[model samples]
Target: MSKIDQFMSGRLRERKDKLSIRNLSTNILPVDFCSNDYLGFARSGELKHLINTNLASMPDYLNGAGGSRLLSGNTKFTEETEQFIAGFHLAESGLIFNSGYDANVGLLSSVPQRGDTIITDELIHASIIDGCRLSHATRFKFHHNDINDLEDKLKLSKGNIFVVVESVYSMDGDMAPLIAISNICERYQANLIVDEAHATGVFGANGRGLINQLKLTDRVFARIITFGKALGVHGAIVLGSKNLRHYLINFARSFIYTTAAPIHNVAAVRSAYQYLNKIDHQLIHQKIALFRNTLKEQNINAIDSESTIQGILFSSNEAAKLAAAHLQSKGFDVRAILSPTVALGKERLRICLHTFNTDEEIISLVNHLQELN
Candidate 1:
């Protein structure tokens, strides 16, 4: 066997021993408590119809972007879509990337210089972490959502300071104290960058996002809004000053080097934004309340979350996996989030609620959770 193969096998065996090995499966179950389609937009027939209609209306639409946006891929339609989305979120301008990961990485990796400092929440998304790593900036992580801790970190930061956070944390599903954080950043003269990936289609008027809901858009230096989660499509956009848009176009390597997203994705994004105005976002909040109330009534402990992404903590990877298997066997599509994706003993069953989920489903899932607990 090759020496590299031996090393890879050893790593795989270690993951197996820890009960934390990862694999992909296509066997989706009947009930969906595992997906990120919080508003059912991904499966919405109306959304699909809107996308089709938009595509048909476009003249000579191409199946793919022939090159990077800087090359042959730039189009009037794509540029218009970016402007429309930015206007929806009340941003000065916007730039689209292939995905949320690309947007986060590109923005973080390029914006902060060697003397700069990047202070992030301890639980920021993996993509943001990767972006920070690629950057030449000094980095520090404060306690998750702890304003005091964030301030403490900010006091020690040098050069140009960038404060990064997510509006809604993915694993814990709790919100960052954006108002407090923004105030702190203003005092420190730090640039605040918010990842609105999970909040894009779940908050604000017409699903604008938590940042827009809080009316802190002007204070924030930059915001990354993704289309995949609640928007139920692909690609992402960085929203900020027109200069920041121009800066990313020239400097963000991930954006500058990669092929531009296809015209189809641009059309879908445009359609999704139009459809966003018509969605009943309050329905999702109702489901979140139902799930949390059920857990409380049954005396089952869960992570505190007002968002659709809910988590039930487990003591170990094996326990979380077993609970997920039990739910899967019962025909519910729930999954385990084991360490080191999260810290040890912070393993959990990540339950995602949706507007389309019935009260019966929520109750039944909570009952099953009670049994596990």
Candidate 2:
């Protein structure tokens, strides 16, 4: 075997020994408690119809962007779409990237300099961590959602301090204390960057996100809005000042180097944003409340969440996996989230609730969880 092959095989074996090996599967079950389509937009024929209608109106619509935005890919339509999204979110300007990962990495890596400091929640997304690693900045992590800890970190930071957090955490589904965090950053003169990936289509008027809902947009230095999650499409956008937009255009390597997203993807994002305004977001919240109440009635313990993303903690990876298998066998699409995705003993069953999910499904899922617990 090649030396590289031997090295890769050794790492795979170690993952297997830890019961943390990862694999992709197309074997989706009948019911879905496992998707990020919180509002059923991904499966909505109406959204598909809107995208098609939008595409039909565009002249010379191509299947792919011929080059990077700085090259042959720049289009009036794409720029207009970005402006529309920015206006929708009440931001001064916006820049679209291929995905949420790209947006986070590009923005975080390029904005902070060598003498700067980036303070993030301990549970910030892996993409943000990668971005920070690529940066020349000093980095520190505060306890998740702990305002006091965040303030403490801020006090110790030097240079241009950038405070990063997610509006709604992916694994636990809890919200960051944005108001408090923002206030703290203001006091420290730190730049606040919020990842609204999970909050984009789940909060605010017309799904402007939690930051917008809380009227914190002006105070925040930047907000990353991802379309792949609740928006049920592909791509992402960083919303901030027009200066930040121009800065990313020139400096964010991930944005500057990659091929621009296809025109169709951009069209879909535009359509999703339009559809987002029409969705009755309260329905999803209702579903969340029902799930929480059912869990309470059934005496099932789950990570407290006011959002569509919910989790039931398991003591070990084996326990979480067994519980997931049991649910899958019962025809639900629930999956286990095992360490080191989460810390050891913090392994869980991540349950995503959608507007289309029926009360019966929520009750049944909770009852099954009750049995497992």
Candidate 3:
């Protein structure tokens, strides 16, 4: 066998031995304790109809973008839709990428130049970490959500510094103190970038994001809004000034080299935003409050979170897996988040609450969790 094949086999065996091997499972079970469809936009018949209506209007609609946006993929309709999204999100400009991963990869790898430094939260998403890795910038991580640590890092940072963090962390579901961080960035003259993946469609007056909710749009350097989570679409956009948009267009490799999102995907996102503007999100907020109260009343030891994502850390990967399996057996779709995805002993059952998730489901899931404890 090839030497490469032998190495691959060893890696696979190591994962299996650690009970951390991953695979795709298509089983659709009764309850959903795990999913990023926080607003249930993915399952919305109304959104489906809106997408169809938009696509039907486009007589020249294609299944895929014929080429990268810098090539043949740029279209008048798509550009106009981007403008609409930017306006809705209260940004001066917006640039869409195929996914949150590509947006982060493109933005991080290109924006921070050779002499720059990136100071980030220790627990930012892996995509953000990968983006930083691809950059030529010097990187430093402060303790997660600790503004004091961030301020200390800022004092020591050299060159053009870019501060990175998620508005709502995906795993822990806790919000970053964006206003405080923004203030520090202002004081230090460092550019601030926030990944609002878990915050979009779930915060703000119109669900713009945490940055928007806090009224710090002008203070932030750039904000990344992901459609896949709350918007329940398939892409992401970086919201910033027109010059920054131009810069990314010229230098962001992920955007320049890849095919732009298809017309249908863009239209669907536009429709989702339209739906977002009109829909009442009070029900979702109520559900979120209900879940929080349920967790508290039951004395569950989850990380404090105002957002929909919640996690209960386990002592070991095996223990988390067992607990997750038990919940799944009871007809809930909770999944085990294991180490190296998370730090050792921080393995957890990552439960995602949704707008469509009923009260009974939350009660049952929490009840099952209490029993596990």
Candidate 4:
């Protein structure tokens, strides 16, 4: 066998031996508890119609974003969509990227110059971590959401300082203490960058995001919003001042080197925001409460979360996987989050509640979980 193939096979075998190997599978489950379509926008017929209407106006010759934005991809629709998002999200300006990963990678890797320092929540998403790695700045991670720990790190940091965090943690489904963190950053003169990936379409007026909802837009240096999550679409944007937008345009390699997302994606994002404004979030909030309450009433030990994303912890990867499989077999789409993604003992069944999910389904899912436990 080729040497490269042998090495790759060996690594995969090691992962399998640990019961932590992952594979892709598709299923048509009866209940929806594993997707990130928090408000059911992904499956909305209305959203599809809106996308179609927007597409109808575009010339038939344009299928792909012909080249990178710097080359040929920067169409008028692209700029308009970004401006619309900025106005809606209460930002001075917005810069669109191909995805949330690209935004974070571009922002983190390029913004912090040499001799600068980055203090991040240890539990922040992998994309942020990767971006930090590519950066020339020194990086330190404090305990997750611990403002005191963050303040201590901030006090010791040298050069320019950037404090990074996620508004709503993707895995744990808990919120960062943004108000307290922002106050501390102000004291330290640190730039605060929030990744609003999971919170974009799940919080604030018209689902602008937690940063906007809390009125901390002015204080934050930048905020990253991804469409694939609650927005139920793809692509992302970095919201900050016009200066920051210009800086990224010139220096952010991920943005410069990558092909821009298609015009169709831009149209969908625009329509998603319009549709998002019309959604009554009260219904979704009620559903989240119902699901959390059901787990409590049944004496199921789930993590404390008011958000739609809830984590039910297990002792090992095997236990979490087994529980997830059993739940899936019962026609629910609950999935296991195993170690490497989370800590070993913190492996879990990550249940995602949705706007379209019925109270009865929530109850049944929780009851089954109780039985499995």
28-118: candidate 3 lDDT, tens digit per residue = 7788768999889999999999889988899778888889999989999888988998898889999999999999999999999888899
In model 2, which runs have C-alpha deviations exceeding 4 angstroms? none
Q: Each prediction's TM-score against the native?
A: 0.99, 0.99, 0.98, 0.98
- Can you write out model 1's per-residue Cα lDDT over 82-174, one digit (the tens) per residue? 999999999999999999999999999999999999999999999999999999999999999999999999989999999999999999999
Model 4 collision count? 0
Report the candidate with higher lDDT, 1 versus 3.
1
The sequence of per-residue lDDT tens digits that candidate 2 reaches over residues 1-373 is: 9999999999999999989999999997998999999999999999999999999998678888989999988899999999999999999999999999999999999999999999999999999999999999999999999898888898899999999999999999999999999999999999999999999888998788999999998999999999989989999999999999999999999999999999999999999988987778789989999999999898888888999999999899999999999999999999999999999999999999999899999999888888785
What's the candidate order when arranged by decreasing lDDT?
A: 1, 2, 4, 3
Against the reference, the lDDT scores of all candidates come to 0.94, 0.94, 0.91, 0.91
What's the count of clashing pairs in each model shown? 0, 0, 0, 0
Angstrom error of the Cα, residue 77, model 1: value is 0.5
lDDT of 2 at 48: 99
Cα deviation of 371 in candidate 1 (Å)?
1.0
Tell me the deviation in Å of residue 294 in model 2. Answer: 0.3
Better of 1 and 3 by TM-score: 1
Q: What's the lDDT of the predicted structure labeled candidate 3?
A: 0.91
Q: lDDT of model 4 at residue 30?
A: 85
- Model 3 sits at a Cα RMSD from the real structure of 1.0
- In terms of lDDT, the poorest run of 10 residues in model 4 is 57-66
